[model samples]
Target: MTSAQKPLHSAFGPQTTAQEALAGRDLRGKVAIVTGGHGGIGLETTRVLSNAGATVIVGARDINKAQDKLSTMKNVEVIHLDLADPKSIDQFAADILKSNRALDILINNAGVANPPVIKDARGFDTHFATNHLGHFQLTARLWEALIKSGNSRVITLSSISHMLGPIDLSDLNFTKRPYDKDISYGESKTACSLFAVELDKRGKEHGIRAFAVNPGAILTGLTRHLTDEELAAWGVRRGENSEFISPEGFKSAEQGAATSIWCAVSPLLEGKGGVYCENCDIAAIVPADSKLMTGVREWAIDQTAAEMLWTVSEDLLHIGSIPGLSK
Candidate 1:
């Protein structure tokens, strides 16, 4: 099942919001778990899914905050989940499994972008740990519920930044290299894209499919690390007003969540998996010198790299022996 990184001429485009993507769909009786669902585009994603009648579980690092944001929503539940902490992830997975609910959609939407150089307790780069490794462990632990659903989709939020960094498997933890925030962030996103590729291939037998999404340049909490000056440099803001502004290609939170929602419920993607999507459709494969940031890079979707990443992730997490996931 190789990736066919080509557009499907989807009805939705750069301007479609999450609500628009699910406008006519009824998700009654479905169960979805959206990580970081209390903030930014994740919040919009939660609203749209719940509005469509799906029972949505909002996984958050801040339980109180999540409750405050989501308590009013019908069919929405908040659970404690800190992606950087292994114990938190394990407990969250245990609680979900104990509920005996089949998981229909798993959106690995939580992530940190361009934060200060830091490492997890395990010494893994913080961005990599939270963005890629955490979801890796969670998906593996939730494998049973996902398989039970008969058909399930996992959407991982990658970014166009994935085009800016190289995956250095030998020093994924940045132990021997000088850490650059942008490069580290890009590497983590690349891991995210690759994770979808390999996971889809491995899980397809059990009716699980996965996709990597470039949600576009949305002004969200994910940019918390960036200063006003940095935002201006990125064209997300301008002048001395210091008020946040959306640049030319920037998307609102609702629009940012569109591709994830589309990947989750759109019939157009049935039997399609392991592809990188943007603007609600599979993206074209661009050349190295293409000068465009819209499509996925070859390294991000490379099967060999995906396989290697899966193996490395298993070894790092010490879950290599997990049934059906070991290399």
Candidate 2:
């Protein structure tokens, strides 16, 4: 279904923390898979979910680091997954399915930002491959498990940057146009938002719902590739005597994860799907001139674009229609 892009007047806002979002909820017995759950907001997402008694499986590129960081957490496990590699994506999905666990929540949270222009072994743009295509393939492979859960949610982490660029379907890999880091990142995020739109449409009848979230700008390792000058340009800073800091209005890692956890378990969103959310509420759709950093862009939630992306993704991944989903 298409997104109306209307606000839900949620009780939570930008200041809400992950712990706060899950305060009254109990996830005891639920099974969740969080991609890139070893660091930043992903780690916080893992912590809070597991704290709430869910069995969280973290998909990490560095299993040792994930294991080390999660050592103190009970009911959490880490598995190897490199979203940039298709083989790795497939294997991770296979292994998870082999566990005979019904997947209750799938958070597509791991992503790269503004890396040097490069392509995967399959020649797809690195940002697109890791941020969107990988999750698409993973979700497709895990369709059965998600269906088995009876009521499941797939949360795809998008960004406000999705407003900055349009998807260049003709040359999605940047084979012809000069590569622009921000634009490439924007396109990938837009793809993520649209993926949620189409995924919800196709899976809703089977009791699966998907949402795309714009976790407000948080100081995370996702910004590791940005240089000092770039950070300065964005008004962020780091002190020789202190820790890295973000500009005013940026959320803390826990705060950044708030919306993700909200979308994953909020009863308010029970019957809704395909909308873009932020600050723990459904975001409004705004025009290009409204705001540079807030609200959902029309293209990001367009039904037509979502459908096109689903077809293109299927062709790119060489998959036919989803098992129980019709074309």
Candidate 3:
């Protein structure tokens, strides 16, 4: 079916480039903070925002890489931020707060793929810690700046992988369940979507809107964990010799970054919040029995689930409240 005929919300497709999405849009005075801005869709996001005249801060774990990549861009600042490290998050927040600049946009895009079971220095699962909790803490720490910047937007990068699993709050670390890292990654992405829902529900009164984006299959560092054979088995084609895929599947990194740019600056989404988006548009709700590979899942967008996960996440991080974030 054509996108207009589809029941679920339609977007520009996985092949739409960032420039195409932001065509004719102007965001000269805006400031955007993007994690993983040195590579993948994150890098494209940074480039697009900067080109549109926004002051883009490139958050990277690797200082040298961030500096090198952002050096050529005007009004771009590269800051060291390792989402997996709480201390690093705190430092990044503190530095930004000291500078006293309001944060206009935050794209929680840094993530890890399926890796062997490993924990951070604090013994949290690598996927949950990096993909969800780390961004959670970072957002919380930057809550003040986000609030201070009127009309601020926070976008979390979720994925279709969320449909593969649900959050396992009972044993969030996978200590009781089998140590399947892929499942853990899926669960973490689910948490990312839910978190955005809760954030928007609570923070909208302050002009801070929250959203989650599913950047359809893009060849980026996030997929580095999968080998060539695994990628082929997963129905992903890389080389020129690959089989022809339908229009519904896969995209380049620039195309993957499109929705984020749209959400960040589009007048079309004014006053909207708490929705999962893909392909430069708000995602349509998924039907319970539908087999469509697009749109947000019910469980991932559940209100109760989102609130429950928020509480659980705070408990695990040992923080009673998100720094400057309050209902």
Sequence-dependent TM-score of model 3: 0.91
Q: What's the lDDT for residue 118 in model 2?
A: 69
Question: What tens digits encode model 3's per-residue C-alpha lDDT throughout 1-327?
Answer: 112212234346667899988886787888889999989899999999999899988779999988887788888898899988889998988988998989999999899998654777788899999999999999898888998998899999999888876788898887897877778888899999999888988888888988889998777777767766777775765657643332346687789999998888777777787888888887777765566768777878888889999989888888655544653
Clashing pairs in 2: none
lDDT of each: 0.90, 0.91, 0.83
Per-residue lDDT value at 288 in model 3 = 52
Q: Tens digits of per-residue lDDT for model 1 on 1-327?
A: 254778999878999988888868999999999999999999999999999999999899999999999988999999899999888999999999999999999999999987675787778899999999999999999998998899999999999998885589999988888988888999999999999999999988889999999999888888777887788788776447655776688898999999999999999999999999999999888775667969877888999999999999988888857665564
Best of the candidates, TM-score: 2
For lDDT, the strongest prediction is 2
lDDT tens readout by residue for model 2, 24-67: 68999999999999899999999999999999999999988999
* Per-residue lDDT of 250 in model 2: 86
**What's model 1's overall lDDT?**
0.90
Order of models, best TM-score first = 2, 1, 3
Better candidate by lDDT, 2 or 3 = 2
**Of models 1 and 3, which has the larger lDDT?**
1
Which regions in candidate 1 have their CA more than 4 angstroms from the true location? 1-3, 238-242
Candidate 1 to native Cα RMSD, angstroms: 1.5
